[model samples]
Target: MFIAFAGLPSSGKSSTARALGRIMEAETLLEPEESDWPLLVQERAVMGAFTALTWFRTVRVPKLFRAEDKRTQGGSVIVDSYYDVLIGDYLGKPAFNWLMPTNDPYFDAASAMVREDWNRLPKADVLVFLYLDEDTWMDFMKKRDRDFDRSAQLESHFEMQELMLQASRRAATEHHTKLLVIEQRSGSPEDTALRVRDRLEEFA
Candidate 1:
């Protein structure tokens, strides 16, 4: 099974992916490192957001392809995030247009490119959403202390969270893929992994 773990920033999807990979002995592909993308160092400014949107589009497809390759070889694969979340982020309020004033033409062109990329990527067999309540989500973000995330307006963060969820649900429905939402908030990733494994079996 190819599984894509997804959630809001700092919601523990990556940690859970790592834990689940260990238990299932599956090959895991993490989100590409931001440090490797020079453009991302700009943070959440117009350049930063645009760079992030474009850069992830550039890299994540290849990562998804690699996961698909491993799955085709009869191995279970896990990915920490997927393109759906990227789309959500792009569509959020104060998105491209709001970030870059009077640049609808560029935004439109970029949107076209991202949509093209999204349409061609391999779909995950299961999309596991690590659902966190609003309070917990904000708490986790604070705990992580990512400067860029911390500095963002709270309202924008809330908007992005909703947009991401909408996108995830849309993807699941469009592809007829299994969508499992895990709402546990206090457990270690190991515990979360065990819960996820059990839940998947229930689906099976």
Candidate 2:
């Protein structure tokens, strides 16, 4: 099985993926590091968003294909994030209007890029959304202590949290993949992983 987790920045995706990987003894793949990504976006704004999005998409395609290969070999693989959230939710979406305006030339370029590459990427067998309420999401963001996240307006994050859920549903439906929304606020990621494991069994 190839499982992919999608959610907001501090939504415990890496944690939960690690836990689930341990439980299933699967190979867990973390998203590429974006150490200076915030700085890049801050420096160039719109163009920066375009660059970062393009970079993410470029790096993510091979990872998805690798996950598919492992699955074909009968090994389970888990990924910390899915590309659909980036492609569908962030492209010309209100949630990221602060970063990429809908009318910007870069926005059009980014959209065109996604359209060109969308069909090449492999879809996950299960798409999990780590759902958190506004207060919990904000709390996690603060606890993570990233300066960029700390200073950003809370409304943008809130909108993103909501839009991610909506986008996850749409992507799952479009791909005919299993969609699982697991609430992350009420329990530990390990607990959530167990729930996901059980749900995957049900799907099987």
Candidate 3:
């Protein structure tokens, strides 16, 4: 079985995925390394590099997926943030907007590359979506040690989050996968994890 956790930044995705892995005694895959192509592309903010990005995706994301597949053959596997980063951050928002300002042929090509990759991946058996209201999400962001340049970008960020959520729902439905939406408002990480584990147990 493959379980995936998707959500916006600081939405408790990593913690919940870890907890679920423990509860299910499943191997867990966290977000890919920061040095990978996705982060590199975003950091560089280069335009007209869609083909390069596609090559990177072809070379890298599959390796991670294959590892997950190998683990699943033996036992259950849980993944944190998997394609969410690709769809939400890399393609949906910052990378495209911040980097590819021209919105030229390369940008269009890159978007298609991202879409192709999203379709290529095997759908999770269970997809858990973690979301918080705007105020709560902003609060959570502020509490983090990261810089707060998001004041201007919040609206777009929220839009991207919603888009990702919709895509997740569509993917789940199309693939006949089980979908679990968790509205995380007031609760400790442990409490949220408990709820996720309990919900998943019903399907188990």
Query: Against the true structure, whose lDDT is highest?
Result: 2
Summarize candidate 2's per-residue lDDT along 65-149 as a digit string, tens digits: 8999999998899999885434654567777776567877677777777665545568888998888887888777776666556
Give the clashing pairs for model 1: none
Which rank order by TM-score, best down to worst? 2, 1, 3
Clash count, predicted structure 3:
0
Worst 10 residues of 1 by lDDT: 95-104
TM-score of each: 0.84, 0.86, 0.75
Per TM-score, the best of the predicted structures is: 2
Superposed by TM-score, candidate 3 places the C-alpha of residue 160 at a distance from the truth, in angstroms, of 2.5
- lDDT value for model 2: 0.76
Give residue 42's lDDT in candidate 2 (0 to 100): 50
Which is the winner by TM-score between candidate 2 and candidate 3?
2
- For model 1 the local lDDT of residue 123 reads 83
Total backbone collisions, model 2 = 0
Off by over 4 Å in 1: 33-40, 43-48, 84-105, 154-156
Tens digits of lDDT, candidate 3, 68-156: 57556776877776562246234635423533444556776666666766666666778889978988887776665332225225434
